[model samples]
Target: MSKKKIKADSTIGLTLKTMVISPIALAYLVYSIFQSQIQSFDSISTSLLLIDSGIVTALQLLLFTKSAKKVSLTMLGILQYISPTISLIGGVFLYHEVLTNAHFIAFVFIWCALAVYTISSITKWRQEQMKNEINMEA
Candidate 1:
């Protein structure tokens, strides 16, 4: 699709998402008001958090979806691992979170799954290349 078309589609999608979610948000806001769950809104930190979680997060997701469309499926699959992996590393090193035995086992399993996927993908690609070569020779 053309850039203009893609932009238009993204805008429409974002609008539709907001339209669908707005009512639920309004309901929650009302509930919070009646329940006195909302504290002072006068704080700059609170305002910044609201903006970051609502607007910034939506824009980031929109951008991510748009960018993901431009990459190949295999590359996208591998790229999906990056964020969680980074978070896990950060929790272990930066936060000094202890990696328990279960966490270590799960992490190993996930890496093993990724390794199997990568190897299979490479093997498939090589097979396809050989098939094409044989067809050319024939």
Candidate 2:
């Protein structure tokens, strides 16, 4: 019933919906193609994956921006940077791909930049929340 609880529930709902959206879309696409016998693996190229993922990334950011009251775009930027850095590292290790020291160092630099952004966003959001609380009390 409380405002915080309502916000939390809304965020949870948004997250679940976002998680399900991609799978449901893929399922639908597969179903639509069920009648076709011919299939080409070339349709699933790297550029296609990048474009699809970019669209999803944009959608998630837009969703979070439209849904969350406190979080800023900067925070999302930081998370986006850090998360993919980690994912890339995992991909290299898991897929047994070639990863040089230069790649690791670049990731570290990106991570550091993201850390600064994360701290700034958190501090900014906290200050705003405190001000809101003070205003509510007055």
Clashes of each: 0, 0
lDDT of 1 at 36: 89
For model 1, residues 1-138, the per-residue Cα lDDT tens digits are: 433345455666777878999999999988987898987466989978887788888888788767766877778878888899999999999999999999999989998999999999999999999999999999
Q: lDDT per prediction?
A: 0.83, 0.68
Predicted candidate 2 versus true structure: per-residue lDDT over 67-113, tens digit per residue = 44455445444555656767786888788878789987887787787
Where in model 1 is the C-alpha error above 4 Å?
Answer: 1-8
Q: Which 10 residues in a row give candidate 1 its minimum summed lDDT?
A: 1-10
Please give the TM-score that candidate 2 achieves against the real structure. Answer: 0.43
Instruction: Give candidate 2's root-mean-square deviation (CA, Å).
Output: 10.5
